[model samples]
Target chain A: MGGLAVIEVVALDGDDTLWHSEQMFVDTQARFRDLLAPHVDLDHAALDARLLEVERRNLSTLGYGVKAFTLSLIETAIEVTEGRVLGRDVQAIVDLGKALLDHPVQLLDGVPEAVDALTGRYRVMIITKGDLLHQESKVARSGLAEDLWAVEIVSEKDAPTYERVLRRHRIDPASFVMVGNSVRSDVLPVLALGGRAVHVPYHVTWELEQPDHDPADGDFPVLAGLTHLPACLEAMGAEAA
Target chain B: MGGLAVIEVVALDGDDTLWHSEQMFVDTQARFRDLLAPHVDLDHAALDARLLEVERRNLSTLGYGVKAFTLSLIETAIEVTEGRVLGRDVQAIVDLGKALLDHPVQLLDGVPEAVDALTGRYRVMIITKGDLLHQESKVARSGLAEDLWAVEIVSEKDAPTYERVLRRHRIDPASFVMVGNSVRSDVLPVLALGGRAVHVPYHVTWELEQPDHDPADGDFPVLAGLTHLPACLEAMGAEAA
Candidate 1:
């Protein structure tokens, strides 16, 4: 709310905030419903319930992924139908699940341009969570790779990691601005560690990124999205000047 | 694949892997299209493109969340209508957006059960990311709070934080097992810190949670979900004994 300082560093969160990662699963789930609609008289709710049960039972055995979900859908159909599910129905579900895995990753709106704007002024870094190979592949394919100063695909965004990152970048926490959708991960830790943080709410957030602790104070500011970030930084830069 | 040890701890990630957090946006967009279909000839793709453009422009300005996304949807609708949008249409969209904020938080199947099972044998912790208030509320409402020994709703989940959590809990890293859907957050860091990790994949993961780094040989074990976690611990317990 006060006069801004030109942000020297801008760190962003990936996932629902930056791109269309989670929606793909929803679309695929819908596709799964459509695939099995003819063979079973189940509504989306019923189908979903059955699939969820199977998924629950197999969570540790199958883990998470489109393939597992799809396979579970097939298994659920067979179970709900008492093993009378048509072969075509089973096969269709499997094929659709495979198709989901192969679907191209789609970036959310404004991401590229916002990255461009921020990169022009601030050292941009991606502080995200996930598998090592998977997150990196997304960054490389996201079309914003060249614009970033560094991409820290981390396991978590806690204080220690943020400190390590700051030490690695040799940037003062005061000059750095953490920007992302998850307030718990991207903003809170940065602010807690004496870094400036700007929260850009994403369209979707994974449940894990949900915060578990109360904020100490008004250390972090929440914004509408990335569009207003550059202007904020410019204003901050002006104030600093 | 090595013989399991007595499981002393379990950790989890929040986000698409857990529940219906991300789909709300997609559903809202779909609802928006349905609302505007009668007045305008705009299809889902056209409307999505416009909204995407607005979102891109507002990323830095607005940040992320249903509030900004809903506003963007309304703005896009108005743009498509050339500023002649009806009052009812505007109110409907606004209501739809507001409705999303009130949507009940839903947990993925097997989560509570998995937590319950693990709780009987091991100390459970939830090391998720998000706004403190929001995430804590979810934990309180999840019905699994009673099962956990501690919850580290962190802004980040990296090696140092993991070490800190272990120290705080007074548990040996070698005796603990981090179970989560994210490879980056739940598995890799714990394993990197010389702790055992079990990966349970979620249906969808935030882009940040995708693994970008290569595993350093036998860094962790991947499981289907928490259902098998008890057995893993039992095997480990036997081996230790």
Candidate 2:
């Protein structure tokens, strides 16, 4: 197969890759800061510090997800307030976290356009990692659901998990392309399996999505964002055929 | 590729596939019964009922492993004995459960020979799922580590996971074959991915390994045990090629 024929499937990553996720998290954190201000006299920085500390300590014990994050916030609020946090304040904080679940998923700039450009030309899939229910909820609410051929919400994006997705879809690794922000979860593993990947950096990345600095050999391309994705796909497609 | 030239990678599942894992568990349960007889004053049927209850209740919280099983035994003993269980007896029962981990792994009759016969001719991989530390430890201690091309100890062996393994090894799904005791975890997923699978029954299977039955499509063969694995691989190779 030559350049154009080499690539058939284009796997797009969700969360911070295609949407403004971390910014939403920041928004949520700000609300948390406001809710606890009266009781704690703490600023956003101090609240964020306490939340991070609680989150770090509870990682293994609580695992990951909004539920855990919300609980951490409540725990931090109670601690900072010296057990004097009001019930209404606590309820408001909890409601803000829950509200995130229903928030309109904002697609990153040019994402919908890029996805549209690749729609008929390539098989497009949403390959993301998060809590199943939460991730699925995001997909449904995103308004880009119809643009994807399939949506894969996995617990992790390791080599084994990526392989499973490809196999399930019956797409050959040589013919598939993974497009995401994270160097670690998105790019490296897909490249390791002889699959192609395009890195589209997000403004702010969650720590888990950071790429591995040291990687096995492969000329994986890095794009500025979704705006640059179509051209990369065109180049790979031409090279593959 | 032509019908006869299509390559296949036949993955042989260790543990319960070509061995007597469940029997060992049953034996351990019997020992537990014997140990708790004096203090519990429960009949064999009653003891079995209590053990099953403990297993069901702890499935999500504790997961599957020797440690969980041992803990269940201790908890059950305490529950049945109603605080009458002696310290010495408790210690002995715990020790009995702990011994299971260190017990010499005994592959079923004809397993090693079957693997040996196929090793030289096929891309055979050992794919089993469990706690990473415990599973790897068992594989290393089993003395079968030297005979295979690769060993995949996974948390789950769904179709996607198997596909990833093949991709990592640079093999085609059409050329891969999965042999194991599970229909849910092994057989079905491979078939879903356009790969072949062979089912080899084990006497006692962990509850998690039990798969619901579906009508066979002739994509893969189901066999009795490891005794038939060599012939199955040869037949699949000839058919694929």
Candidate 3:
């Protein structure tokens, strides 16, 4: 907080941080787990692991997004059902994916206000990693478009990607602050690059996005929600006083 | 040619224009066709039709790039063979995809030089549409990275996408020229946006990328190869003079 005087750029992550994302994936997966349970003799944990295995295996080819997730679900279904997955179940997964895509943009509490508050004072932008069209559409639907300076829909949220974003924008890493939900992605990457990051925990985090280390043990600032952001920044700003 | 003075940005398409892209896809599909041939009574044309059908059907959800193409191939194999596709054949498709991913970058003749010729005079960029990581990796591997201003790996190439790119880069469409292989993607979009486009036709075009209208019959400049680009530009420059 004491080093806050140097901060100039505020980059926000989409998905869970700004809106409800992983919950849709989680809910659908839960239903999928139950739907496929009768056909396969596995319990919930094992079933989850099976789907995760497919997702991890297909990550290189499929990448991340609802389409990839849907494909992975179908593959998982086929694998568990021994290639006997019902046509109806595959249709259900497809429908689930469609619904997720069609899901209305429900911005998290205090997001619009938080972004508005952070806009004029800082170089505000949204740097999210997902399917370009999907992410772009979500941003369009979120109604936060006019408030921010830029929307960077990237492929990943690794340290190098964050560094590249900084480099692209001609922003010094020391003066950038990244805010997001994922410790592995939004928090650690920017932190590693000597950029500041504030973690705002989402209730449902994707398994792959969970950090290896205990997130609580990390030195980066963690806040309960975005509504606390203005106060948090103010406290840091006061430190400069 | 008369509009040469208006040109300020030369945005090149990556895949087929700068390097050999669809050739790899064509080759893999050929191998896949052979692998699936004995299992079905369909001829090569029929097989190609089946694969094309599946690819068209999945284009929306699977999106574009080698990953989607590979998934489409697998799904086609499953559908055509009525779920009788052998495990070895499936492995072959996976290996085919991996091989495509690992394929060496082959720059087209005189591309670097053509881009180099235009670099200093214009705001050069490479704007390609595909899976984000895949296209980004292609640009990195293409060795033309340093020769351009920026590499935009977009979800789609349409008038709106081009408009967005121009807006992002602060480029004027009237002063922009897009060069690429596909008429559907590279040429028409920019042309529709009042930007010029040069068609450098690749021998093998994706079926989906074939413009509905004949490009040869259109008003935009069409060149045989990348080597001819500089002269074509010079002719336009002469018109302006």
Candidate 4:
């Protein structure tokens, strides 16, 4: 507890951190590449880069979610095929989007236990960014709803968003710890706002959410997995005591 | 100043109430029928009936919004054509969704004046139900954001939902007023919770939201148009005075 390390609230990221999310996007993109192989020989890297370009452009208008992703896929398909995209290809992409939406929520290593462990001891809420319907679907299907506090589905994860959420609940950011898989969204933003964060790396990450720089010393703690969360919190608690 | 007439907050339904919403759905469905005419000779009424059936079924699974509407169109297209729906039709329907998403928000008559008039006099919030993104798009594009106290994009408009929104804002439901076009969603539910309601009928009504029967006496007040809202509130305020 070197300086204000006592945790009174825990904010969890929905995708990849608590459950498998990025993997679906990854799989969808791979299938997209295969679907268009005959029309173009663009490698996966180049195709992904093109898709990201389209997604970033559409983000302002479309925001984020599976629907936006599906739109980007269709836009990319049209772009690569020079607007000669076959009718079947467009429908196939739509089906891919539907599959992503219909996919079941898969909880990672230690979800309810980690969240349940901190329930009464700390005010816990899930703060995740994505389409509200898609995010709510993940929450409803996750079966982790009752074990935690409210689930906030926001447009983006930034300092202002974090501040608003924390202040609304009357929780001081200094005592708040955000647990998630992205350093860019989950860790750095919280740290910037004087809140604590714990990084639990997933097997795959969304390319856009990757941070350009590394975390410096005293920035935040990195956990091997969610199972290690209670220990980390307890150690911090001991230091504070 | 009839009875319990002082108003502290005004909750407006987003689509149809504050802006044109159902008309867009009607126009899109028209185009859908035309596209499928070559495969099936179903009349507009029959086509609309089938689409509604599919939508009701998907409501539990897909929820609502432009995205769900597009998916339902695709599903209906497939069902009517016995899985022989052309790829071109799928692309065409997707275009319709994008168009709806991209449509400019047209504020109903005197919406700004109504919301602005009530802004400082009461806590004003838009309680809209639909796809969060679609509803959000309308709000963002409506140019009415600055006047609203808050915009609550919800999944359903039931008694419990209205109760939760009111309790969250710490407003006594008795002093709150709900204004919208759907009696089923806006009037009955709010009135059931002992709140007042103002019904402003839209030109077109979605079949699902149409009330099964007429509202009884003392159900709520009815207005000819949104232009009449400020005056109605004033009358109520005068009564309480």
Give one digit per residue, the lDDT tens place, for model 1 in B72-181. 67567767876555545655665675466556778876667766777776677787764333455567677777767766655467887788667866777767777777
Arrange candidates, best lDDT first.
4, 3, 2, 1
Off by over 4 Å in 4: A1-6, A28-54, A74-96, A214-218, A235-241, B1-6, B31-40, B77-89, B214-218, B236-241
Q: Which fraction of the native contacts appears in each prediction?
A: 0.00, 0.00, 0.16, 0.15
lDDT winner? 4
Specify the CAPRI tier of model 2: incorrect
Per-candidate alpha-carbon RMSD to the true structure: 18.0, 10.4, 3.5, 3.8
Clashing pairs in 4: B1-B239
Interface Cα RMSD, each model: 20.3, 14.4, 4.4, 3.8
lDDT of 2 by residue, B47-104 (tens): 9888888877755444455655665676677678765655455556545654665677
- lDDT string for model 1 (A1-241, tens) is 3444546888887766666666676677788777666667888888877777777775433333443355466567666666555544554554565455445667776678888877777788888764333455567778888878877755457898799778866878877888778778787787777777777776655444567757554555567867787887676566666
Rank candidates by TM-score, best first: 3, 4, 2, 1
**lDDT value, candidate 3, whole model:** 0.81
lDDT of each: 0.66, 0.72, 0.81, 0.82
Query: Which scores greater on DockQ, model 1 or model 4?
Result: 4
Which ten contiguous residues of candidate 4 chain A have the minimum total lDDT?
A212-221
| Residues forming the 10-long window of minimal summed lDDT in candidate 1 chain B | B59-68
* DockQ, candidate 3, vs. native dimer: 0.31
Chain A fold similarity by TM-score, each prediction: 0.69, 0.85, 0.93, 0.94
Per-residue accuracy of model 3 over A35-132 as CA lDDT, tens digit each: 88778899889999998998898776567887667767777777788766654555566667767777898999988888888886887899998777
Model 2 reproduced share of reference interface contacts: 0.00
Model 2 TM-score (2 dp)? 0.49
